[model samples]
Target: MTHRRRPNDRLRTLLKEADWTQEALARAVNTLGAEIGCPLRYDRTAVAHWLSGTRPRHPVPQLAAEALSRRIGRPVTPEAAGFPVPWREPAGEDPVTGFAALCRSDAETGSRLVLQQRPYRVADARAPSPPALPEIPAQRPAADRDPASPGPPQAGAGGPELAALHDAARFFAASIDTHGGRHARSALSTYLADDVTPLLTAPRPSPSRREMLGAAARLAFLLGRMYEDGQLHGLAQRYYTYAHRLASEGGDRATWSLVIRAMSAQAQRLGHLSSALQMGDAAARAAQGLAPSQQSYVQAQFAVILAQTGERRGALSALATAERAAEHAACGQGGSPFDTYPRAALLFQTSQVLEALGDLPGAIGALRRSAAERAEADVRGRTLTHARFGQMLLRTGRLDEACAAWRRFLSGRERLRSGDAERALREMRRALRPYRNRRCAAELLALSVPLTEHS
Candidate 1:
């Protein structure tokens, strides 16, 4: 005779079926929290609550679904686990609270004690899905130009203090480009909180405040990108949030688009496919009236997120649309914030999408084009593209090519401290595992040892 399963028994059954340990579950939950911009560090006790039939708050249920799905090797909806459904409020209705609340709730519940007690699976983090979009458009052409330019600097020339802030921001951005995200994230964040934040929040703000606000927004966005690249998603989310708010205050559509892009990245990383899609859609709409290049770029980024979610068809469609927009902008057929949308950047994005979709040959071809078009002076772009190419080559079993690519990538990144490059090295080591005894593999391994040490 069989007995009915108790509430906790259901939890145990789920864990057993998923084959995850409590610590593993906790780690997955923490990762999910980070993806949504709500940094959470949970212990085992939090997992206990869910098994007892106590519902986690709003966003937690969705996160739990994501965490659970990874372990089960199937999609797990919130309803499957007896949780409330996810909701998306219309845009322009309390934008800050609507977005922030969703992220916060998801983070809290995903990291709750009840769920963390269950066993977790690391493979869940890398589950195959759609590819992410690669086109990020400049929101405002004027903002994109040097602030010191003659045609009425977006923010007036009178405020020496504002000028100084712009200089400082440029200095930080240059450091990030020269070094890697790992080298720059902490310092950038410190500067924002310690130096930039005070200036923005100073008493008796000026009417020309939009310029200062825009500057802060850009700084925050870059900092968030660096953090995200460094795998510090939780911290990145906070910075994105701060930037988004600043953008709203400035009423700058371009900055707003940047915020959406940052949010989309977070959603995709966290396994929130629907939320990620929604963010991209929102961004596209917000950028619709902008110049063709800007619109195309935004659309491309949307495509990247879609690809990451395993929406290959949608990703391709979006890519095509972005290309057309870019062409139109280049021909001066329509207004574009910038006259030229780096065609090479679009190619690089396509390569990334192809790589994610397991089209190794296609990825390789695209990468080749991207490499050819990329200028040597664009060190950051070159380092990133080469690292990606190396990773894809290793995945496709082109061990020699992978090694060579890594060598080039490492040489370019050597002058800079790069977390992404370090990750590429680790990936190369893992890929070389199958051929450990081969001479080429041995050579690659020897080269990676120092990379690991530095990382």
Candidate 2:
């Protein structure tokens, strides 16, 4: 005899609360599925089957949950939607161990942690306060230590080992900037899991341990960017959370602030405006008493967050504060990526604020200056900047000039494998579609189509 399936009461309840018909829910789910490149043709019958306790395959459950979440204006996890639990950051685990496990899982081909996309929860934006640092023991002589114990040598603790880790982090960071994360992510993941995690978990003197932790935090932050470049946002968020823990434990308040601000920026990009504002505020608070450059960086991002939330006056106020802080900030500190706040970045933030506040002309001007000031080494930044500049130019009816800007973007885009770059190509195609009658628009549209299709 066959066992009968129970109806998904939880999903039915959610459907009722959302006041959506079966067809509407199915349409929403299908739309989301397409957005993630997992095309679906679910119709009302599919929704009806789901309500009758028929579960779908991998990612369909997630897409359905996200569709419901968007409709209800809150997070709805797969489990809440009467499906199996999706991969999430292991709750209540030690951050270092959890980070290690996450890296290991991601390194494995086709692991769920890397394959599944978890819906962004607005509530998770207000992360828990940093854990208190573990007490450190007195330094012991090398002769007294166990040969089997895992750790760096005392003689080379803060010297060679730390420098080597710093150098590795810089190389990975630069590689990501120049080629996008696709080219270097696998090797980076292997290095983090096989090398950095051991140094983090091993017993060491406080100073050296803290330095190692700081370096690990930066590397984790880079890993998050790599995941983000691949459009695995949930994985990226988990990495960012781990990075924050590492920075906090290491007493690196500046890096902690930077990571938090990066989270804010991610939230903003994903349309979680309220969550973005909250995270931005936390980043500003965390930046207190840090270097002027760090403060300016935090404040500039906070201003964009405020503007996006429609707080015009507050956005301008925060921008002013950021400007004042920048006056005292020295450029090119030649330290960690978080150590310096360059004029180019500030101007880019300024453009974001201005565009959000309905000053398109001002935004365009700031964006041009930003593109000019940006370092030549930042290929990804240059590509994205040019794409954005072209979009703005198109918005202002400068068709020929916009085409020129987008041509520059395409030149750099060939060297990268970035989700943002892909999205820019799609956006260019869409924007130029209406003007296909014009010679310039037709040329650029033709140029963008192949790229968008390949992506």
Worst 10-residue lDDT window for candidate 1 reads 125-134
Q: Quote the lDDT for 31 in model 2.
A: 68
For 1-455, candidate 2 gives per-residue lDDT tens digits of 12235898989999998999999999988766544445578899988888888887667777788888878988888889887744644688887788888877777877844343554444566644643433334666545532212133245567877877877877888887799876688898888888889888888888788778878888899988887777667667778888988888777666777889999998898787887888899888867766677789999999999999999999999899899888877653555566667788899899999999999999999999988987877888888889999999999999999999999999999999887788788888888889999998888877766787665
lDDT of 1 by residue, 355-440 (tens): 66778799799987887787555566677788778777777778788778777776876776765666666776787778889877
In order, what lDDT does every prediction score? 0.62, 0.79
Top model number, TM-score: 2
Give stretches of model 1 more than 4 Å off.
1-152, 155-158, 203-207, 308-313, 328-341, 356-359, 395-397
How many clashing residue pairs appear in each of the predictions shown? 35, 0
TM-score of each: 0.66, 0.88
Count steric clashes of candidate 1.
Answer: 35
Model 1 residue 412 CA deviation (Å) reads 2.8
* Clashing pairs for predicted structure model 2, backbone only: none
Candidate 1 RMSD to the real structure: 9.6
Error of 2 at 62 (Å): 3.4
